[model samples]
Target: MKNIVILFALIGLLVSCSDEFLEKEPFGELTDGQVELPENIESLVISAYSILNGQGNEASNAFNSPASNWSFGDVLSDDAYKGGGGTGDQNQIHRMEIYNIDGQIIDVVQKWSVLYEGVYRANTVLKALKNTTDFDEATKTQRVAEMRFLRGHFYFELKKLYNRISYTDEDGNYLSNTQITPEEIWTKIEEDFNAAIAVLPETQADPGRPTKYAAWAYLSKTYLYQGKWQLASDAADEVISKGGYSLTPNFSEIFIPENDNGEEVVFAIQYSINDGSPSNYNGSIGDRLMPPGGPRYPAYGFLRPSQNLVNAYKTDVDGMPILGNVDLTETDNVDPRLDVTIGRPGIPYKDLGINYEESWARDLATYGPYGPKKRVISANHPDYLPSWPYVTAANYSIIRYADVLLWKAEAEIELGNLEEGRTYINMVRERAKTGCYIQNLEGTANAANYMIDTYNDPFDSKEEATIALRTERRLEMAHEGHRFFDLVRWGIAADVINTYLEKEKIARGFLTGATFVAGKHEYMPIPQSQIDAGGKDESGNPLTTQNPGY
Candidate 1:
């Protein structure tokens, strides 16, 4: 990030050039003192938020550093597949899906680059705030709080994806990656959120801006990641008891473009289309490759739902998750969320009035026959861009109310409060059971055997409660990009993912060599380019070190 921001000073230095430089105001041509002006400071803060979609004034290359983390989060997990033309299409991602990942991969470098770019932008705003004077004191404090909130978010992503990233702040303090511990990095993340919480307003006129409740939600998540059970639970309780967020009536309705900023969303990346931009830069540029190729939604098909995730949704006669081996290829009584989350062969997809068929999926022989349905706006909607590089205006929520409920549940279970945990789990289940489910093509019949029920009774023990909690989280949060991380955080990544690859390879032959190594694969290998460029040590080695087993 420091390398990318090349600040230059001019003393009327000029080079004669062609007459095609737009003949307009140059981008970021401000002097250092002018950058600290009140208006420019406000623009810089907005600039920090602009990177949330992971685009940087370009129309392409978004797949490399999508803020959604679809590549690292969903494709790396058992939840989805690298479903494009074949194994060779975007083959780097194929290498990731098969666990042949290398530190030299583009995703490793670009994702790291974009996140640090976010940190740099946030710090730039903070630095400008520290020097500006004409700004109102109250508003200055709020903007400072907002920048810290964003910096915390960026560092949180860095901490989870990279584990031990270099840390820097507005006051010019820089801690090398080798010099900082993951625990210290986590502490820094918490400090930023605490600073934000101390000054932010309870609400904002602009829906995308963080509120006090948003900071609390993020803090709860940070504590949950660190296993601070009591602190995590308390922070979640603050949101639940005081935050005015709620679940929308229908499970499927929450994702449509109309509800992008609906009640359930706590913090989201704002996106829009047809807002007078030369391209769909303000749209879901990162997720352009995700739309399933169908008559209604015509686009590249990537991130197909894995059959393992489909099997996880199967229910028994009592609407409880079937813990035993149910045929991974077939479906029986299942939760309604399965249809809402994934597009299967015979289901009526959205409001298109046609059934999703095996023909709709690309590279079906390699990736199998399923497409992601959640967070995918209907092709007929105005928010979808129909031209080349199809994108959408639908927003992506970084934190949602459902996530808060589940965090509290997990903390409760870990703290030995099984009944309290079950109650929270039941709340999520009850919404799926009673909410709007997938209807038939004509809207006259039911789709699949929708048989979902809540956990109305007590669990026999903590082990049983823990299993229930994890399963409910998977079902409720499918394809929203929380599957693999959930498994890793619980320390069962090796067991669960290896078991998945074993069973799934039998159905899809392409997964023959995929493996998940516990100590090494828990976090991605640090980008080799970063290590090479990250200064030097006394022994002439790169200062930044790689994660274990890299």
Candidate 2:
């Protein structure tokens, strides 16, 4: 595959021109004659990788189609709030947060467009590879595998967001609206990943490229989401036993610039800074996530962590979560991850050496007291480019080894391997216990009485293990944007989110009447723009149907 630098340069040219003249075709687009050359084919494959950051054109920020999914996966769930200037400042996201979304929302339309746009790019590469005969058979097979992996990832995102979607391939032919079921989509996704696995190497020469192990990890997750316990467990086992991946010693280290593609990262979106491009394509979403106006950090303050999520970190005397207990006391022990994930009162904020004050919040009355810490980089850090200070160079991990272990535990428990499940869960918990605690600037004391202990005994039943797994995942993956989807896959989005809204409404008055309607709110409505645009079939019927609610 071609490097990201070349890909980025080529993407700018590709999206601009679409004329039919074969002699003047853009560098990014491949004509029938161009596909026969190995170099041109490689560039096409690299173009597919370039859109991983969701940047199609340079004019607007790709907020709706960000690789992070912070809006859809985190804010829409209990993990965060749509915190900006106010509810009016990205009301569509707020509507999503409050379960008041519709088909006409621009965020919905952009997200749908960008993802399908990704599918189109991947299909382009696949088509080119299929037609090329100048390359060696070995190279051809490998390139095909890589393209499939990219396509699988794009489809997986669509599958998780909108349960019922149209399916398409390299020919640009899509199934009639809602013709495919979620299970069928899952099967296709699985097939793509499996094909990638057959030819991908265990490790890639380039850091951003996916490997066989990355495919395995994703395949395992795909199966886990579908409740295919045995398949999920086996796939996870293959990764754990042979993938050679390990957790980063410090949880806080995972997000820093120096650890861009660390050992803990299974796969991550590669980002570069000072790449001579004024476009924020290489910059991270963290630029917008900084506290609205702080002494050092300045940002829009979106995706604020919820008080319920903050409270969920509270632990009992035994270093376990204070489950079923709402009355949090000063003496309540809590997981260290709370400090690592969120910025609250009196804690050192993102290596600034100054405590995060409640006054730093844009509007405490509307959003909350907490701000997201996981994505913010210290202004003092060397990677903090003055050119675009808001857009840091932090690479966001799509899958980490810790995520794999947790999924493994979930699958094991579901498959009746209770003790084995406990072992995997504890491995993650044990890793969390060490080198993860933040400390005072003086380095003389723990940040917030941090304490986290592993489960010493076997879970009494699968339900017990399930609760532990769910809570562990929330605390482990908090602001990284996996909470909502996890809740949906567990079939408990309604209960978990409604209960969350009830508590949150009392704290953040903006969520006064918020409620998660079970069946309908589980998936977002299909974009109206897509429906209006070529969403109809041969009989003039709508090819793209709206989701049940809107």
Candidate 3:
């Protein structure tokens, strides 16, 4: 494993060589022995983050492009729903039937390939570091831990979306004829995370490095997927108890750049426009999804919020949106997070002036009651953008303290510690209200709304409580991109999503051609190319079993 670190350092050394050698770049063709210098290895290791970029880039704004279509399928198809216009290419997502192959091969299949490629690279680093003699023992151990953490994280994505995913070895090759069951893959992921927990330092020594707590946070999620409630609870608790993380008083500040690196974030994807290219799609998620043809110029508000979700926000104590108990309008102060979570068309952006003209050709709208407002970013002004007040690059939170606390609450409830569970839930709620950025939970009534009766008991029955918890998870994590994964893990995608579709259609008054397929559609259709490469299952059939329906 240390050999991998040494290998990277070697690559960096070579990269620093004379202009001719650097420009000509003979290393790709060179033998390992020929290019075994310290600098080359370092360059290669540093390049691994680019592989992650393949999962999300600047053009798509991390919203789920062609690569993240499964995320959209798992979410928009049934658990949640949205309808918008794009060219056939763009509209495919709206219709929930997106699949296309491009000339460069950079689509969903490529993303899957690249994720596994990342795994192979990390494994190579781990194996090299294990055998390297030149690196210090401490450095070797830490490096191995980093690779393991990365490897586990990659596999976690595949397992969640695709169910059974193929594993690879150190040399960027998949194990032939190997098909790991979902449970077996979880076991492997746990093993990798556990190894990371044992060896990673408690704090990061550099940007993007994994820490002991990062390992624990990821393992907590892994355990939850595997149905190990106690273990998941304990792992999250471990991070909360001593990891030096805490909830930020203001939930919005966590997203704003001026307040980044706060207590709430455990691990976040680092972004810098001046340092390099901003994420290709991540920088544009909001604008890409904005409503089309409105006063808000150049915005294509894509992620439209459902009226159902908008109504979910109970009114202020006095029952007004921005004020008390008045007839709520589209723009209400019911839950400030609703604006922060999902943007509605009629809602004023506060910053938009009469001079602004929105770009609807790209599906952006600034006026009228039609556009989505969540996670919209401005290349010029970030004070209004969720990611930050000044930064162009939106930091995607991979793990955060708030999630751990919520998980603690859920696990405790499932374990039958109702009081303890409520305590954890309240901790999150209290922070929301008292934290400088957010208003009173019920708005200026008790100052601590959770202490009051209205917002206190989220559900009537234990089953209802579970549903409430899941809903909270969905709302809290929306657009940070966790909703789809949560639905799939619980195997509730079909029912939840199809219900949403019917509601969407009913709301929009569309009667005919409304479709909801259950069972296999809950899981994504396997990429056609993968089936082509692997052939069929037992019956010598095409792998396009279609999950139950087309």
Candidate 4:
């Protein structure tokens, strides 16, 4: 057993020094007094977890190094636009949104530094644990597993964003040219998660910590991204059959502060407020993207949902999307998730009882007339500690049960089990059927004509099932930061995004010449700062080769 009492003694010290890991020299010899004790070793582990929120970095702005993937994953895809004052606001992101990104953008460099900084912190924990002799074997093993799980997650994000990345660990030298292939990177990520699964318990006392099943779900996701159908299917099945996770009864409750870390949450980033700290480390990036000048708190309107995404909610009488149809009228039958996912005009913006209006938007002409609803907290919430009225105590869900189910469905369909895939898809759609609609303050009527239905018949063919899976994922997880990555993984980003831009140009004038170039735009370029820092090999050759066409 571990010494819990000793562990708590160093928790505050660890959190206070988390950001220092990025600047601390890993190769510097540590004195025996630094991390030789059990309590100090445990503090290093806690420090690793503290950086998971991706905050407190002085190298970049909060919007650039946000924990949320809204900039690249949503705005860069067909799901959203880089909405702010105009095309020039946060112009680096706007450039990325329109496929004009370079290797020198601050956002790219900041994100790269933040993720690598996380890897460094995790490595520090592992290294300290290896050297510590006073810790119990069981506690040491569990902490090792936890650190590796965090390391794997950070590398996984780096891999998806930049396919070619340098590998590092506690024992490994910093900025070394490892020359690992993409396949090899995926293998390393899988190994970490597998090791985590082997040692982690089924349940954790703290909900923020990863459990054995969280490792399984993430392993499944890694496989799905790499097109390993059978492996993905098996891993997902392990979570489904053994992981005791289920869909939250209501979709709206999934994002609310009170229901955070609930039954549906497989893993989430824990955030706290009013802890006598000036830093907004616990505040989520979503808080910064709220619509501006509302009766409620003021917000910076970034990552506005695209019209194509808004139109995607339009469903037929049977709860099926009007595929290939982009024009949707307000009176048209639409999926109930629309209201839950977005704040449209004339709808109540939450329990505030004030209706959302076009005036809520910063500039309707530049972006669109929509505001994200998932991350906004009610002013009346008990945990409402609004620093500058843009920070909140909302925990961000990184992996949820619904995401696992969808991945399983994707794997099943890819493996030729069309009917099985349809069953999983409908499971999500069914849960979304109830409590998905937003109603008026009196609760007498729905704000909009909300409608949704599950697939009653088996998929006719694999092609049709694939399309249904794609559309379902778009509607179910829209604006949650999965759109661009999904498209890239499916090898259809070029087709889907180009088509979206072509159609959207007519409605949103800012995207008149925006284009998504294939091969080059699939992954972001390695930041020029990283290249300048350590781009060369021992032979003076470019070790960190930039992405093609950068």
lDDT of 4 by residue, 197-244 (tens): 999999998777899999999999999999999999999999999999
TM-score (C-alpha, index-matched) for candidate 1: 0.94
Any runs in candidate 4 off by more than 4 Å, and if so which?
1-24, 27-32, 56-60, 173-178, 285-287
Model 1 scores worst on lDDT over the 10 consecutive residues at 1-10
Clashes (backbone N, CA, C under 3 Å), per candidate, total 0, 4, 71, 0
lDDT of 3: 0.53
lDDT digits (tens) for residues 1-550 of candidate 2: 2235425566654533221111123334545676558876777777778777766556445666678888888999988888889999878888888888898786777777677766776787787777776788898888889889999999999889987877888765667455878888999999999999999999888888899999999999999989999999999988999999988888888898788777888998887766775555566733344444578766578888888888899987778987763745556688888888998778888777788888888878888678888877777886665444467677889999999999999998898888898898888778778775888778788868888899998899999988898889999999887999999999999998888887778768888888888889988888776666644567878866888867
Q: Model 1 over residues 1-550: C-alpha lDDT tens digits?
A: 0001111111111111111211212225676688788877777777778777776535467787787888888888878888888888888988888888888888877777777777777887888889887888999999999999999999999888889789888876777788888999999999999999999998888887899999999999999999999999999998999999988878998898788778898898888876654476777888888989988776479888888888888898899898744554344788889889999889988888888898989977888888889878887788888886688888888898999999999999999999999989988888899998898887887888889898988989999999999899888888777777888788898898888888889988878899988898878888887777678889887778898888
lDDT for each candidate structure = 0.82, 0.79, 0.53, 0.80
Evaluated at residue 517, the lDDT of candidate 3 is 56
- Cα-based TM-score, every candidate: 0.94, 0.94, 0.77, 0.94
Where does model 2 exceed 4 Å of error? 1-3, 15-30, 285-287, 290-292, 325-329, 387-389, 535-540
Better of 3 and 4 by lDDT: 4
| Residues forming the 10-long window of minimal summed lDDT in candidate 2 | 17-26
> Which one wins by TM-score: 2 or 3?
2
Which pairs of residues collide in model 2? 177-543, 287-390, 535-543, 536-543
